[model samples]
Target: MATEITTAPHDGSTDPASPARLCGRLLGRVETRLHDFLAAERELRTRVDARAAAPIDALTALIDSGGKRIRPAFCVAGYLAAGGDPASEDIVAAASALEMLHTCALIHDDVIDASPRRRGLPTVHARHSAEHARNGWEGEPRRYGESVAILAGDLALIYADQMMSEASPSLGAAWAELRSELIIGQFMDVVVAAEFSADVALSRWIAVVKSGRYTIHRPLLIGATLAGRPELEGAFEAYGDALGEAFQLRDDLMDAFGDSDATGKPVGLDIEQHKMTLLMGLAMDRDRRTREFVLGAERDPAEVRRLLDETGVRMDVEAHIDRLVEKGRAAIDAAPLDERWQRELGAMAHQVAYRNS
Candidate 1:
């Protein structure tokens, strides 16, 4: 018999059939599956050559460091809500794959953004660069570190594909679409940041495609697909899209006003990079000084934050988040899922929209 995985800590609810309880159990399985898979891969590479395992070590370290695990949570919630079997290992594999892909994105994104930290630790590229510098290793330290980070990210992407391959063949199309969309969305984000056009429409499109759909919508759809419940697609899409925008907006707010200690990453990165965030776009549209701050050559994140608050853009965005949370709840309420799942999903929407990190 297989060893049973433990669920997340409960709220004193002894009922095992509770939707939250079941989803927590599934998420636990996903966590275990990820650890086991990476451990085995590390062991396999170590036997061949100790140095060969360095990238695996980096991948393992990042996974262990800590993340929100939002994608996997949404995936599991979608599966359970769609009535997937609690015992099915397929969902576990799929959820694990989603997390691996997210890990891959993070590694690569840090390189692109030149972010020095993640989860309160030196980012993969930053750490490796320092290692290269300290050791006086080959070529440019930055180049060497970036190269290693890229390779590690590639390894993660490959591992994600391998894990997803264990799932049913029916998921091939959706999986392909998800992967491609992530790449395309990232590409668009990079391009828009370089342009810094202050186009609200463009910014909104990037937000929806890069953060909203990628973070929430696709994961939910993948879960529904894995549960063999294609009928839930429409409702899930609506919920995911609305909640996803709210999620991204909250992220923007956190970057602007949240504590670095709590977020485990540098705040105001969006402003520093001059990336046309949805919040920034709204601020520019609503206030002249905010627009001047963004368009000016000497942009200061602190000044932009002050401008946002002064112009009431922050309050407006908060109101928008509330509306989106409600919209997400209504979508699930109209779905054919059981009331328990609807409530659980609604709770999730609120959590995502209001998260501080």
Candidate 2:
């Protein structure tokens, strides 16, 4: 039987005691903590020199722009599902730290990809570059902008580490591993894109390390570790591995065929940049024409889209995502969680797999 998943609408419940409401409340608190922490940091920087806070402003703008907040959501959900105390502020700080870390990643990634926009607005580098150009800055506008963005990303990383400093000592190893994996995975992504290899195995490895483990697995485990339920690591690992692939597949599908308005970013960027995403890797494997087009010096996004549809690679990936989702759900189901948490995690799997943005 196909598993059914439904998202509950917000009922405006104020009772944090309710299990159904606890996760939602905690998520709200996480948002508040981020806003408050950033505000305080901004204020302190402004006191030193108003101009010195430009990087902080850049970070704040990106956070305010809007995101799915997937990492923090997973972290908090993992902690709560593992029966952590609802009243503990530890989870809030950890979750906020995850978000700050994500901000760092996005800022640096934009610089690396030379992406013009993010979340429906000009990216930090793009905005700063334009400002430099308008102001007739001393150095090249592009270089100046990228330099500022790098500094901003570095600052965000520092802030993330500061926030995580107060977390349980048990989190030290996990935190270090997660940060290193992110950096290494990002380097691998850049290398693969430049090489433009069609190696499915390498592509899959990059996806798992970069998107899968970093976004879902580590966050969940961090939450579980904080809750003193490290045993849940095995189940969360299985679940994260499966669902993370599904999440990346969905991302590829959206980048390939989704509307820019809905996605809040340009489409077909991976193809343009020659990034060997899992979808493109699968397409190359399934169709000779796709393989040739991708490897050829001149690439056409329209042609690739047609090949994906005509070759049924898109449909195949959709089916594959369904199977991965089921695999994730099974892992969560087998874990020794209460019925409510089991259901919550199951719903989360579906949400992550099927998200449009």
Candidate 3:
């Protein structure tokens, strides 16, 4: 970690405890510390294996790329809500580790999606694939590039584990569980993509494992456990589970229809891949032409959007998001935390449900 993490100057009058302020503060600190840590690692790798360092270079570039920092923000909020020292280095490192884990997941996810762009930039696999072609590599350019991208994601996972090592044993356990579930979700994703008919139960399970627990519940649990307030686990779990699932559904809708500038990636990639999502599942069941269209090889973004709307998939998705957010708000209200934390959590839930970027 850096000797110090500097962020935009703030005063007490701004209510540092507010969700937005707290998120900004923690995200700023996490980025500063994360850069410092990666720089040191890069130096070490450069000295040991200069060629192998390329993966780490890619990893750092992805880190520097933009993200909402939602997972880390949730980590900080969990610590604060559970009455931990919000200013402590341990908390910052833990949150930064969660961000690193997210980086790993996204790198792998982009590869799985065969996505060309992310955060409005070339994806790691796509970038490396292009580089291989430019440099006149001997083997298949795509394979070489994907291989490097896989190594980069592996390094990121290692970095995430290293970041979490300083935290308590309980925190480490949560991190392990998250990674395991992520693997299971990825396996299920591959299977669903290749074989399964659209099944709502299967789709929801994917959301729960891939996005719900890994994205929110476990991160919050890590923070809360590190805060030494395990008693608040039940309420935060309820809140995290609901918010996390809603967060993912909203993302699916955005990737299907949102503008590239707003979502930071080209839209309709999921439709192009024919991945089974709740939105797609609902539409597939309700509309035959939509199912036939999406299941076939050719992708028509216009028709996908029309089906998404005409089949009421968009409205149903929105309704589910609203309901889940309400469930999270109720959990926040019932949690035995400070009133300020309650308000902040309510606001967090709102942001999760409503954010476009």
lDDT of 3 by residue, 250-339 (tens): 888888888888777888887777778867877788788888887787868788888889878899889989999999889989988888
Ranking by lDDT: 2, 1, 3
Q: Which stretches of candidate 3 lie over 4 Å from their true place?
A: 1-13, 17-20, 287-299
Model 2, global lDDT: 0.87
Write candidate 2's Cα lDDT for 23-120 as tens digits.
Answer: 76787788789889989988887987899889999998988887878898889889989989988999988988999999999999999988898888
Rank by TM-score (best first) = 1, 2, 3
In the predicted model 1, the residue pairs found to clash are: none
- For candidate 1, which ten residues in a row score worst on lDDT? 1-10
Instruction: Give the local distance difference test score of model 1.
Output: 0.86
Candidate with maximal lDDT:
2
Off by over 4 Å in 1: 1-12
TM-score of 3: 0.91
Steric collisions counted per model: 0, 0, 0
Candidates' TM-scores? 0.96, 0.95, 0.91
